[model samples]
Target chain A: MKKFAIGFYVAVTIALMIWGYYQAIYVAPDEQTMHEAQRIFYYHVPSAMVAFLFFAISLIGSIGFLSFRRNRPDWAQASDAWALAGAEVGVVFCTVVLITGPLWGRRAWGIWWTWDARLTTTLVLWLIYVSYLLLRRFAAGPQVQTLAAVLGIFGALDVPIVYMSNRWWRTQHPAPVFGGGDDSGIKDPTMLAAFGWNVLAWLAWGLLILGLRYAVERQHQKYAAQEAQEALNEVA
Target chain B: MTSALWTHLVKDLRIEWRSREAINSMLFFALLVVVLFSLAFDPRGAFSQEIAGGVLCVATMFASVSALNQAWAREIRHQVLDAQRMAPTSGAELFLAKVLANFLFVSIVQLLLAPVFLVFYNLRVEGNAWLLAVVLPLGTWALVANGTFFAALSIRTRNRELLLPLILFPIFMPALLAMVLATTSILTGDNDPTLWIKLLAGYDIIFTTVSLLLFDVVLHAE
Candidate 1:
């Protein structure tokens, strides 16, 4: 049942992504300041949302690991795999946010980059998760896994601080107003619909990737256990 | 109850006094950081309160890191943590003792640096220097409290010296930010000290409480 649901979800997600891309190209707003290339927001935003979700999942897994021992490795591993999957997609999206943000900034704000809150925080978060993955490479065994889980939990704690820091710093150093309308930046109803669909599509893709990754991890664990058993038999 | 706490505390202090290399190295490194900052920046630029804010921020981070590493290094090197765990004291007592030791150790460095920082930076401490008195103790408590916890956990790892900062810094950023802002304001004579002070108090309370709660699971993980 879980597999069926995941498969259906994957199928619908791929369909939605195709639709999202088509809509983005044909129906979405033509960038007044950023040219047609600014349509990358649909993909970029969804990827970021998924990435954040992954971090959240990683935190939840860490909490579980900390709370329950010996009986929770399966759940822990599943969560770990999903978190890693989400991070993988997130990095891709962060790349998109990074590449497109500067372009948008140059076109709209007339600067390549301003070290604004969102950009800086997002970049820092990207570096952080990248390190989180690197740390996992050195961490092995149940003990190390739990330790990495603790690190993952603490690392995700930075997300809120990063966001708040950005908000505080941005307000402290206000940027000059370039665009005429309200700066909340959510202007159109159609744009909102497209954005919502884009988010949905990206979330579906994120789950799909995580499901695949979990299966692979389970197989790896199985092989590892088999190898250990064979080694024990040889010793006997 | 109070005697039990004090007993554990005295024991830790005695243990630390026996091997004082960690504290000595930490003090040296922290002062060196400030001197490096002074040399790296032009003297006029370095002495100003604005630059002092940045230096103070970096100083606390370095001091905290040094003390944390030392605190854990002693435990791991001596293989004393497990024995310490097997002692009559609870994990809570152990945690509190370590954090207090960390607090004392870092505060000693802070005390040493204060006079030098004051003279070098020409800091006046005009509005409520009492606030500085309150902030340093509380600020160092928060920094060292969290640092000691992370350090304890990191010591169990293969490469503690590297992993400790990666684990501690991000979690401690909020406290560090509040400390820097509060210290900066006090140094720079910013009038609105209310919010930043409250933030420092809040950070100290929240981190200390959380670390104490999690100390058992963290220590016994091995």
Candidate 2:
């Protein structure tokens, strides 16, 4: 059954990607101002949203891990697994966002990069999570999990402050195109359709990746537990 | 709790006075940073005034990191932290005491650096001196509180010197931003520090409360 599910997921992801490519290339109307360069938005924006979503998941997992360890120690491993999975997946999507963002900017703004609020905040968010992963990897001993969880919570809390500070400092990036105001958003239904389909496809991809990562984490935890039990038995 | 805090604070100060390790190094590091900044840019140039805020804060941050790194290292070195673990005082009180001691040490370093920063950067404070005064201590508290907390967290890690800054800097970015901005306004004679001051105060209060509450969890780990 698990193999079948894996097969189904792979097949569905391929199909969705193919459809999204077609819609972005052929179906979506050319944006009046940016023309062809604007097509990158269909990937860039959704990737960023997915990245933020994963970070939020990691935040929830971190909180769950800490609270569970404090109040119900039996369930702490599961929470730790979730936190690890969420952080790893979040980093992947954030990398996608960072890459696609510069490519999009080179085309849209005629510059490779800008210190805009959103851009700087996204970069800082990536750094925070990377440090989170590093802490987990290097901080050895029994307390590593708790330390990483604490760092995760701190990183999660900093995200909003980062965004707010950058916004107040300066903003060279374009105003939001959707829900920004009456002055923005797509007027063409085809453009909206393409955007909606691509967002759904990316969300589906993110969930599939997260599921696989979580399974791997759980397997690793199981192996570690078995090894420790065997060692205890040998000592006895 | 207050007595516990006072006792720990005095103990840390006495240790520092005897050895003169952390603060002296921190001060020299701050001075070197200022000197490096002066070498990199012309101090009397028009551009220096514009960047003076960033220069001063970055130097202070680097110095504070060194100080914080030493703050936990000494305790962990002699197994003093292990003894403290058995003390009757709550973890919050002990954590608060360390934070207060670190705050005092970092503030003194900053106080010494300020005059040097003015001379090295050729900066003149055009805005209210009172505003500068408020911004300095509030910003220092914001840095020291989080620095002390993360220092304790990172002490157990291998290569803690690298990990401390890695964990602290991202968390410190927002407060640093507010501090630099408020200082810039003061030095540039902008005269409106209300927003930045509020940000600094808010950050200090929130982190101090959160750190005090969560410090016990950090101590109980392992």
Each prediction's total of clashing residue pairs, residues at least 3 apart in sequence or on different chains, is 0, 0
- lDDT by residue (tens digit), candidate 1, B1-222: 456568767977897799876578877787788888988885574257777766876786786786678766877766777787787766878788777777787777778778888788777774677788877776777678878888887777777778777767666666666677777777767655666667668777766777777777777775
Model 1 CA deviation exceeding 4 Å by range? A1-15, A31-38, A70-73, A83-99, A112-124, A172-189, A234-236, B1-8, B45-47
Model 1 docking grade: acceptable
Provide the lDDT at A188 for model 1.
72
DockQ comparisons of all candidates to the true complex: 0.30, 0.78
lDDT: worst 10-residue window of model 1 chain B: B42-51
For model 1, state the Cα shift of residue B37 in Å. 1.5
Task: Looking only at chain A, give the TM-score of model 1 against the true structure.
Answer: 0.81
Q: What residue runs in model 2 are displaced by over 4 Å at the alpha carbon?
A: none
Per-model C-alpha lDDT, please?
A: 0.71, 0.87
Expressed as tens digits, the lDDT of each residue in A41-105 for candidate 1 is 77766776777777676677667656555677667666655555555556666676677677756
How high is the DockQ of candidate 2? 0.78
Count of backbone collisions in candidate 1: 0
TM-score of 2: 0.97
